[model samples]
Target: MDKEQVKKLRAICRDISVLYVEDDISISAQLEKLLRKIFNNVEVEKNGLSGVQSYTKNRQDIVITDISMPVMDGIEMCKRIKLINSEQNILVTSAHNDAEYLVKLIDIGVDKFITKPIDMGSFLSNISKIAISIYREKRETVLESRIKAQQNLQKELLNGIIFPLAYFDEGEIVYANSSFKKQFFTEIDAGDFSRFRLGYLFENKKYVSMSNSELVQEISNSDDKTYLVMDVNKKIVKKYSISVTKFQNAKGCLLSFVNLNALNEEINRFSEQVDYFPKRESFSQALLEPKKSTKENYEIFCVGLKNTKGFIDKYGGAKMHSIFNSLAKSLKKEFSAEVQSKELSIYLFETNRYIFLVEKNLDNSAIDKRLSDFGKKYNYAFGSGLPLELSFIKENIKNTQSIGDILENTEGMLYTLSTI
Candidate 1:
């Protein structure tokens, strides 16, 4: 290799730690001197056995060994090292050009091979290439770990809060929280949320009366008390006191919902005690108001009970209700009151459909494992080994569309699981 190429090789190998094994004292000394100049740490062993011992004590980034040795050969030592770490990079040096020996070394996962009386140029090029490969692998591993940690942190933040909220942009609903999904989007599929429009959600004629541009202008001009009147399942007209604020650096707006009844109750309490309170305006302003989106993350788990009608028919209404209550109690115990508290709710929809809304900071795998175990133990509640199956769907509360869309999606998934 040229001087510039040798310099580049030395730079690449500078930080790498090496383990070199050779039986000949003269050859070992010459190779050790060259290796010490290029590598940060160079460990030399007289035999394969000592090489394995040193490698076990402190694993090096690269291992270069001779095929012929006493006690243990290079092939045997490399085999042992591969068992320790399958990804360990090893380069073999051998005098014999025997096909069987070369095949054995390849079978043991040797990274590269160098001939006896090693050519300096070839050896430097191979080692440098291996070092670069190791560097890339390390960088990728670190990047993957960092991404995983960030995702986990987002999930944790989402699980900590309980409220129904949604974000809207350009007349479209972009995100909804767990409470919003359970309350409104209980029967819609999650993927279909992208197509759902914000205008179709409001039932109040006054709010839906204006054009999209006119409505956006009205909302942007003034921060007023607006209500979202939703015709939930075409059966009930549920009203929520909604507040809109422009999302920073974005063209869209954030819409938060506060239960009308809850807000009214707070207002009524404040009115009655107005005489005793000094900061009446501030206190009332803060009472039951919609919060700014923290973009929290949470996993939504839909728990469905199979064969509910048959179980109810055989066990009676009172017995079925008792079993459901018992199941809810068991679930609450497993998920803990501290994490969920009032957030864990069991809603009985239709005749045989039961959906449990659990809001907590848990990854899908952990939640699935716990529910699987819960299913095994809770099935006996039906008196006759009743078949209980559970399916879960996770939603990043920050990326949800509408509550109605979420409900529709969750119900659809439950229906598929029940049929299966």
Candidate 2:
């Protein structure tokens, strides 16, 4: 064998960890030297019985044994090893290079037969083949493990949530979990999702009819971290919110569809503070105010709450708005369907400030109770006022530089009075 070929075979052998077995101690000793040069770790056995012991102890990568031994033959030893690991790689070395011997070895699961004084060239070639096969098998195992890890991570991310998440590639749906697949039409084949792009199901035709130039521009202008809000027309339901986010490490975007109706309802309750507090408003005053009348008008009522800072730290304002939106949806159920003349509204103002506006009949005490409950639930200090008139809406805005100035100098209710 050429020196380069020997060197390559030796490298493979070093990585393989092998066991060598022969009945003749002198022959086995000579073979051990050759094996040592090729493999960094090679264990040799004088007899088949001893070979099985070495093989079991080291659990070597591959085994090579002579068939004619004193106590145990190669076939019997091979069968024992195979019973432990059926896919074991084995080679039989024999002086009798007959077809009958080769057939028998093959039946006993011998990977290859090396006869007589082994040809160094043939030995090198056969070892290379076996090395490649084992490497491929191990590689497949690692790849499968990685895929399973990714699937588990996806499951954990979406746990306890009912939203549908899907993945697509090159204008076709490649894979989707059970939740995501169920969001679309039932009994869909891969071919169906592939044929239909995301735009097919959206009510807005603009998304479907966009030109390639427009698409490119949108992608360029889009924030790498942003999501697309899609309105889906479901078979059973009319519409839902579909959030599409492109994976930073992968091709194609991941789409998560959440029912918008459900979200809206949540927002209403959170904004109205009906989620955590009872809706029964035990106001000291009778509900005698006229039903809200419609005259194009707007109002802004400032509410104060010592944020989580305990009058020292700031409340989580932006996040609070998010939660408030959820609360408002739950609160809407408190109102009758006919009570639509004047609607309750909520907004997050600058810093720890909040603005609320609703019909006058909503007792001030009821609003205070809700605000107090919110403060206690979240553990913060807060204060609120009655709804303001149309003329004073702008002044009551939290960030209005004048708002601080007005509150700093004025008394209750008077602080929000209109200058106009």
Candidate 3:
């Protein structure tokens, strides 16, 4: 090829990665230098079998092979390479310009047919055309892959077990998955599917006017997921974990939903189990002496929940109990037996008043925040006492003036056993 022609073909090759398969070692070696002048990376394989291996491993953008070789012939190797990479850019080179062999390569998606005694000029021109074709093909492949990825993601989102999903365009429901329909028993007519509200499925007229636009907008603006609980017919619907995604092709929003009601129910049951237990003071009489050990401290810190009746009423008996249970579990996980609880020995106590003993140097702020979260659920306040030794802590519970005083005058539900 002339210098200018070679330069142009070289630029095209620079934009591509190619593989050459030839049986003749001397020919392959000489062509390697010439290919390197035009292409940045060229892989040369001595036989058809090695060519297939090289293509599979390196993901070659262009493949050029002689018609005949040992161990595996060009036809069989091309078939194998196609099985590995159906979109491979292939050019078949052969001295026999016969119709049968040329047709065979064409059928296997070969891009160019060249006769060898190898005319460098014609060869370079053919490679330039193949390079442009390969670039266009690659662009198409990328577009198809992106589209497939989006479709797969949509399928996965709609397939969730715990989440009831919906997608909104403006304030109207644009799409909903099987779980949403199943939950609502919604029979969506062709017209109803276009612009419908969540209230369409329920008997009551409560959520009919609730605007979904703001919710969708929130999801679009934030990168992380958001969650909230909405009341439906006076029943707390639990936490609805939501994610909003906006699409570029059109001004539409994707909304994802997770029904946390079951989780809330579990939390409620756990809380009730923890709350209804016999007063810990009953266990105080059997207090065992702390055994010295290397593994863990033999101390206990108690946390008390005082005046939580309002909280129980507001958050529902079940949910309040769940919150308490969660707190108790968290405390136990962090402090273990270094924690204990006992009702006051003195009968001058109140309803729903107890002392909790905690035994760790855990961050008081974090513990307080966790307790505060519980209080928020019940719409009440909690108070914590300073930590103290388990012995001093158990004894102080006996000094409350009255049940009313214990219930009403306590600082919060959370008290430190270390300072009590």
Which prediction has the highest TM-score against the true structure? Answer: 2
What is the per-residue lDDT of model 2 for residues 1-420, given as tens digits with 9 covering 90 to 100? 778977777765566788888877777877778778877878888777888888888888879899889789888899888877888899888898677767777777776888868876777677678877776777788899999999888767764456766666655666666666555534444447655455545455666775423443454455652333343324544345545677687767666676666677667655555333232121101112222223323233554432223223234544455434433443344333313544554433322233455444555455556555543454212232222112112222232234344344323333343222
Top candidate on lDDT is: 1
Model 2 stretches astray by more than 4 angstroms: 1-7, 56-58, 151-162, 167-174, 178-238, 242-258, 262-420
Instruction: Report the candidate with higher lDDT, 2 versus 3.
Output: 3
Per-residue lDDT tens digits for candidate 1, residues 11-96, read 77776789999998988888888788778789999889999999999999999999999999999999999999999999998898
The TM-score values for the models, in the order shown, are 0.47, 0.48, 0.45
Please give the RMSD of candidate 2 to the true structure: 15.0
Task: For candidate 3, write residues 144-179 as lDDT tens digits.
Answer: 999999987886767664456666766777667766
**Global lDDT of each model?**
0.67, 0.58, 0.59
User: Model 2 TM-score?
Assistant: 0.48
Model 3: residues >4 Å from true position, as ranges? 1-17, 38-40, 56-59, 70-72, 83-86, 107-111, 136-165, 168-174, 177-199, 202-322, 325-420
